[model samples]
Target: MASDHSLLAHLVPKLTRGVEDAVTDALAFILNESKPCRDALVDMVSVGDRRLASVANARTQVVASEGERLDLVAYDTAGSNRLIIESKFWAPLQDGQARRYVGHLADDGLAVLLFVAPEVRHETLWVKIARQFEHPSELKLGSTRQVGNMIVADVVNGDKRIALMGWDTLLAGLTNADSSMDANLQQLHCLALAQDEAAFAPLHAEDLNATVPRRLMAFNRLVDGVASRGAGEGWMTNKGLRAVPGRDGYLRFIGFCDTDGERLIELALYVSLKRWADLGTTPLWLRIWHKQAIDLVDLKHRLAEPGWLPAWSEPNWLWVPIELPLGVEYEDTLDSATAQVKRVRDIVVEMA
Candidate 1:
């Protein structure tokens, strides 16, 4: 027969204290590195602002309602432009107390909230926080977990909560970054060389194959030579590309490219760690220049219909035109899938 003593015995006060002490140690380690934590907070704000620029008071904390109290708030004071911050460090409290803090934050309309507990690692706290948000009638806590001991979160109503971690696949991405960069430029140069009548001639197959695996591998070597470094997430621009580490081994890249001859390109690449294992097709997304001039809906149907290898069958060759940045407007014209197809169509359209 089961005994009540068995369960109650394990819940001794001494054991509970020991666990509390351990969590305290973890929290202390995280908070001790002031610079990293601050940098992480800045990154979190930048991400939120970029994603949710429509909201008013973008980076400031609101006044708490009658029975609430908050820890930190990041918001914009005037229409999402200038940023404001508010933070508080409180001693570890009971579950009810934590819930109260979160509730206070919700009432105050804080765009971002940070709760720094010196007794528990932020990751452990986040799981509890996520559940809180699920029930708005109750309370929702927000935070993040990143490589090393960084934590941040989005508390704003419409803000995108980004989960950041150390992704090994990002290193794999480096393996081909530089080579792809150079080849893209070279292909742009080659196409320019083909002026007027030459442009009317068949596009070079070699130019189309420019940013293949070999070039990507060479680029990784170049990144390796420089040693891995982070420029912080806040550096992201509507035009520049940024690579961010993600949970497990996934890496997310964001940026735009514009080549000569007035063609604009914007691309987002998601490189999975698993891609390196078999070297299979790495998931990719591209936004290219002058997209509206093409027939995307027709192309999508043809692609799904199968046995439709009209021209460039090699996935590698399809990368050139889509990847290389040209100097023109291209967003409304094409999507990622259509851009890749256009790279091949550009050749066939000319050949025909």
Candidate 2:
């Protein structure tokens, strides 16, 4: 038999390090050799006059500074101007990590902080982090306060600026420059896409396993209980309960719980919208257009009720909140989930 310590034990950790290294290497190559890639990155952060070639001057690395390590740091050849980037492939920014990064950069002087993550939603997480700074203010695009290209926020008495860039946006820019890129740079671009796919693949692959089925069973029990009471007589008519494939080919369920075209509700086993999208399914709110029939103010009030947990919503769907049990085996959680589903059903029925 193999010992407790084996080569495979370290494989995942090594792979994670390798992925980060590869990303950093690719970024450095782009900033050095490709002006187009550099310009795109500069545009993302809205660095007014600091072009990547002139300021960065091809000096980029995975930098260690003051007991914290940044994923990639591009500094000028003179070491005066620096662009610090924190890249994420699978993991997210840990608690207080963003705050520390912001504080550190603010004191460092004239630095632009960029955070690159797998999804755009991470941008929201970063924006919330910026709000926690000593002084946070939004840098508007024009007359209206809108976050364009990135959410640019000033921190620490306007000493440092923090910007969020999505991996997709970055990749799109890289893809556009593919025609002019050398063989090595092109290879790096492909590697970045492949890494993203690897990072996101689990969400689709794991859906048919024990966890999803367990959650679906719990959701079905809740739906059945409401139907038995005749509380869902007219609205909860679709009884076919199983995981249905979404646009991304991930197994998600609909028809298990729905409204009479007046409201939208769905229970997703996955944690975030990225995971749902990875599985090829449209979020419930995005699937339907029922805003004309539903009052947004009333919908918000209904969502505030006990047992109803808020999911994503859109202009057309108004509000779609769903009940997700803490654990399927727990009787209390099942009851809570059931009650939540019942409450939403009642609200829709009343609206109808």
Count of residue pairs whose backbone atoms collide, per candidate:
30, 6
Runs in model 1 with CA error above 4 Å?
1-41, 47-63, 71-75, 79-90, 93-110, 134-148, 152-157, 160-352
The TM-scores, one per candidate, come to 0.24, 0.45
List runs of model 2 lying over 4 Å from the truth.
1-17, 47-53, 58-64, 103-110, 131-147, 175-178, 182-186, 198-352
Q: lDDT per residue, candidate 2, 1-352, as tens digits?
A: 1111223222433566566666676677667777666666665665554333334444444445566766666665566446778776666557666666655443444567777765635645655555444343232211112255555555534556677766667766665765576554445545554455556433445666799767545444544454444334444333453545443333333332345443244432222334343333322221323534445557567667554444344444433534444435556654654455456556755654
Least lDDT summed over 10 consecutive residues: which range in candidate 2? 1-10
Give the C-alpha miss distance for residue 335 in model 1, angstroms: 76
What's the CA RMSD for each of the models? 25.5, 16.6
Clashing pairs in 2: 246-280, 246-281, 247-280, 248-280, 249-280, 250-279
Maximum-lDDT candidate: 2
lDDT of 1 by residue, 86-148 (tens): 221122334554444443332332333334332222344456555555665443334543533
The 10 consecutive residues of candidate 1 with the worst lDDT sum are: 190-199
Query: Native-vs-model 2 lDDT?
Result: 0.51
Assess each prediction's global lDDT (C-alpha) against the native: 0.33, 0.51
Candidate 2 displacement at residue 127 in angstroms = 5.0
